[model samples]
Target: MKKVVELRCGSVDYFGIGAINRFEGIMEQYRKRGITRAGIVTGKNSYRLSGAWDVVKPVLDKTTMEYIHFDGITPNPTVDQIDEAVNLLKDIEPQLIIGIGGGSAIDASKVVAVLLKNTGKTARDIYTGRFKPFEALPTVSINLTHGTGSEVDRYAVATIPEEYDKSGAAADCMYPEYAIDDPGLMLSLPGKEVLYTSLDALNHLVEAATTKLSSPYTVMLAKEGISLIHRWLPRALNDPADLEARYWLLYASVLGGIAIDCAVVHITHPLEHTLSAFRPELEHGFGLTILLPSVIRAIYPAAGRTLSEILKPVVPNLKGTPEEAEEAASALKDWIGGLGVTQGLSDVGFSEDDLPELLKYLRKSQGESGSLSLAPLPVTDELIIRIYRESL
Candidate 1:
């Protein structure tokens, strides 16, 4: 007899090559739900560049609904920025919040919505696990970038500038009420942005599949996401106008997000978070690209078989052998390099002199156990330092 598996995603979702055209329908749903006022959260430029803002503006203009726009968000959003958005949102008291752009903007919108409903609670409280909201203002995530899966999951991330700490926060209320994944909106993304964002999605799949909480269902999603990226990312890069490639990459990112939601991410995420926390200039995906192969090499002894198996779908002609881990890691590194992202930590403005500061942030974020709980190997501080050094 064969075993059975159940798969479900909690949020209402819409995906199509040109699904962005349905934005007006989403607005109608919000109105039907008795939402009279809406808040739109997005980056300063992405929504405009992608023409999403133009499409949205007319919809809002024609409707009776009152709306406010918050476009101050930046990449690697800080807790302080969330507080700023929250302060503004509380004033308008919208019934619904719409998050647009990439992960940073979407994440900011989620945290801001939570703080708005649960007044008097700060982002610091959420980041430190002191305040967990039971309810948040309804949210709709409109994805303009195929990265971070923030559009579909309950997980939201923020950084503390003072402590240089970056962490994830989860609450039942944090999940968006609806997700809009339109590959057409992603067409305007710069080549480097596409590369970095796709890499982030790939990292999400890899980390989710390798985590201890991984199950057959989540692993299947991870493998499919990896395969999609391996096949389409390069093609998307080669021809940005290829709607077919863009559609599949966006689909892969959704799978990656769903996989992480079910299985959680591992060390690579925390390490990259620390790196970006210290060096805010470093894009999250770029940092992951630099560190991924090194981290894979570090953990191969403990998780070689599993890593090898999981990677076979993405790595062509991968043999099911003891050396599979090494081959997979090498292939992945070559792929990343082929995409023209071969920068090391030093190349990105890190030095041995900065190691102590970076280490401090890493220790504070991951704590004594480091990322060992999620990693297959015993991830010691020494090993982490070695990985950083090797990445450099």
Candidate 2:
């Protein structure tokens, strides 16, 4: 019997690898369509490194276009920051928005694009389960990192301070009108960030492939992403100058994002967001690395037979029926451990005391979180606490 599921996403045009340098060339296309003014949303670090500011300055200078820059976005952008970015957008009144940099900057850009229209409610109101922001401006993304496929998804997560929840307000409105994936920008990425973002890509693949909601298309994307990550992550790590490896990783990263768009990520991200939000000292990739093994152990047992088959390609050692797939699932943890991050919470500055607080936060957060809801087994507050304790 053929299973069925509905697949839907906002329109996005993807220009991969070397297309970044052609920003001037593409601006005419958008301009011809009346997108004269654009808001440039980028990370201070990425904008500087990718020469994005320089590339666009010439284009903006030539046209009736104007740009406003908001560089305050951080990894796992918070609700407060999105409000600020949206306020900036309202003042700029851009016809379009160009998001440059990593997932955080891109995610913030998605939020800001929509929040421009909603003067009545705050972005915080939208993020904290208070309201949903369904309207957004056209957004374009120039991706500089290989993780957090925020360029392709309508989803954007922001941590709400008052609610103490890392919820997101998602609508097709948040999806970028176009995503420019130029590996050329990735050439200058810091070694540590490259490593962490690749790890982030790997996490995205694992969660998407293993999620209960994973469909055939999502599985295919996940498998390809995992395979590419497995092959290219180390090469990029070993030869940081290898543009080929970086390019492949970037493609893999997009595949991971596509996988998530189809499958919907599970709770691991929200869980990691909880920790990352509270402890900005801890890197986002490092937090996921620490939490992944425990998360996999919790979810693997409950994943579908189709998921087990999907894993077979990425993790080729498992053979036999779906029931027997559990044996193969154990190998996933080992595979993740090999990816340059093998440490516990304590190793990353977390301790026993953090467990109770993190669990409390997780339990109180909403049900749609990619990590908790997708677990093969039903997750409870106790399970999250136990995982944290074990991770520590």
Candidate 3:
């Protein structure tokens, strides 16, 4: 039997079945703050189609709070998108900001909240540190998918389409003040999204468990998260309406998010950020799935013991060696392939010719998130190229 769990991390998160009830309490707090205007950030359709808008609009109405929304959020949100959203949302002078979709939408909402509070600051200005603000407007995330833990973590990512630069930032002010994760709301996910989001959560577990700062907390959360995903992801995909499965998968995602918040995702997130930048069409989780096995092999030297322990759900008998890492990577590839995420970087329009540029942006991208430093070993140019080639 699953019970509703309320976790207080940087953000207070409500996870499990019927967790949507907590939204009223959140809005009550805003009402008491005399927050009259609310700004919403969500994708074009998922906000409505996922049944979130139907469930949330009434609460705001009861509070008699005025609200405005930017429904233009997309899969991989861009700098222009965020800058434009900030420009549009500035008219309302919102006191509260709510991000109501997956990572892309929630990440954009976090960026908008930051821009709104630090008036006249562009998304680029804050992300690049040309204008570093000490505070941001309080925000909430009504998380719709089970992948990105953006609701609970202080990190946000967006791509610069023109320069092919993807920006990721971690700051104290970026975390949502309140968040929701209701499994009932997750039933609207399509098959592809269900697989992709679950893969995203699984990769988070693997990478977070092995970072240089892997604490007992990180490893414990990651192991349980990975195990839950293994047992439940396929069930949800097979029976898309499985509330129990959705509960566990979303719970696992929360665990992964909290794990990464403490340990931080290292090499995989850095490289995947670059991959999606190279080809913006590639989904974040899709890029992670394609490169995960290669990442599993690359980090083994530094993280073998951790990998061997947490990964036992999939590769049950791993002995945690260089040879076993290869075996584990192959096994993971086969597992993910079975779920239909078999595309390599080449399949998604990346090639050897893009190598030099990918490297240049990767260097720039790594500096902000500092994910590369947390890696067990130096992710040299040669090794990066090798990982790219192997994924190809």
CA lDDT, every model vs. true structure: 0.82, 0.73, 0.84
Candidate 3 regions exceeding 4 Å error are: 1-8, 366-369
Cand. 1 TM to true fold? 0.94
* Regions more than 4 Å wrong, model 2: 1-3, 304-315, 320-334, 367-371
Estimate, for each residue in 146-170, the C-alpha lDDT of model 2 and write its tens digit. Answer: 8778787777777776555766557
lDDT of 1 by residue, 316-381 (tens): 675445566677778878878988888899998888787778777777863313334778777777
Question: Residue 333 in candidate 3 has what lDDT?
Answer: 88
- How do the predictions measure up, each by TM-score? 0.94, 0.91, 0.95
Best by TM-score: 3
Worst 10 residues of 1 by lDDT: 1-10
lDDT of 3 at 291: 88
Which residues of candidate 1, in runs, are more than 4 Å off?
1-8, 317-324, 366-372
Residue 276, model 1: Cα distance from true site in angstroms: 0.6
| 12 Cα displacement, candidate 3 (Å) | 0.9
Q: State which candidate, 2 or 3, has the greater TM-score.
A: 3
lDDT by residue for model 3 (129-165), tens: 6776578899999999998888899888888766666
